[model samples]
Target: MPKRIQSSGRNIVLSVRDFCEREKDNNAPLIPFGNVRQRVAAKTGISEKTLNKAPTLSSTKAEMQNWIINKGLSYLPTMVKAQLYKIIKEHKEAPIYEADQMLQAHCHKVARLPPYHCELNAIEFMWSLVKRRVANKNVGQETNNIVNLAEEAFQSITAEDWQKQCEHVRHIEDKLRERDVYMDAEMDRFIIELNNESDTESDSSSEDSSDSDYSSLAIHMDHAYSK
Candidate 1:
């Protein structure tokens, strides 16, 4: 958490560690911070000593190395378990959501967007519209005026616009899901074709080796007869 202090009439600098200490001094509820190892151990009921022994398992490189050492298993169940524990720990100890819950009485259901899919959030489009309006207003006279203009831009977005954006997001979600299904089907087909090709190649190689062996045997018999 960074503390923003007004140095001279709106010119502010952020001090992260100092701000946290200052907030602590002010009796602000300190954010809950959990260690990765401890969190994973608690979630999975795995002993901390075991986790410490495989500390590198928390990392992708270490997971990949473990996979290689295990002879290239398609699925490393242990690695998956470790990753799940890490994910659970991260979600449980998220600073913002945890703080929000502590400060607010109302139950918050946080719906997170998929990674790199900001377009799915209608608020993103609404903000773009608001920023465009603010830029057009050219409220550069004062910071206060700029703030007012931005607020005005935000207020200008109608409920209809919000509804439309929601509808668009729904449509995009359906399309994305459809695309995922198509991709999964294509992947399955590809794997089947690959396996068939490999089997065919193996059969061809076996036939070639058998023919070579037969030819060698026939030549040896002819030599014996000639002798």
Candidate 2:
């Protein structure tokens, strides 16, 4: 009806026929994408919950076909199915958080510690020291005594105390690194021995290799605490 209407395209008058001809080559798909329908209102059925409704992983290899069936997708070739899976499981970076912006506004930087590493946290050790001091002084359990003792406990901490806690964390890290090195060496040695045994057995058909050739290491790292 508005075949002669102007101003929408800034000089190109509206033409529904021309628009349909240009878009016929492209079907309306991937509702997340496609054109802006009316320049403002996005089309419906474009939500995350709808897009991510893929099949769950199963013990068998039927999940791929299940995904196709659930999505009403046509039977795809192996290569195309693989590409679809890759797109479905693509690694998406997390959304930018407001915490970063708030920190920048106050001229403060954000320092994130590794997850599940309380021993590596300096503040955790400091809290332990303060709690011990407060427990020793607040024997009467009075409210004011507890508060005063806590304040004194926190004030008693010095630079030397913080340095010791940081040093302790470094020591733990060093021990972990040494243990990793030892484990890697043991694994390499075991693999080499197993391969040699297999080769010897193959060379001499009359004699079978003993199970002891693949036994656990006799000389292991000291385990006084029994792991």
**What Cα-based lDDT does every candidate model obtain?**
0.59, 0.61
Candidate 2 regions exceeding 4 Å error are 1-85, 88-91, 192-227
**Which stretches in model 1 have alpha-carbon errors above 4 Å?**
1-96, 139-145, 191-227
Which candidate should be chosen as best, given lDDT against the real structure? 2
Residue 72 lDDT, candidate 1, scale 0-100: 30
Put down candidate 2 lDDT per residue, 127-162, tens digits, no spaces.
999999999887778886788889999899999999
In model 1, where is the ten-residue run with the lowest total lDDT?
Answer: 216-225
lDDT of 1 by residue, 95-117 (tens): 34344554565666556678888
Q: TM-scores of all models?
A: 0.43, 0.44
Q: What is the model-wide C-alpha lDDT for candidate 2?
A: 0.61
TM-score, cand. 2 vs. native = 0.44
Which candidate number would show the highest TM-score if scored against the true structure?
2
Cα error of candidate 1 at position 82, Å: 8.3
**Candidate 2: which pairs clash?**
none
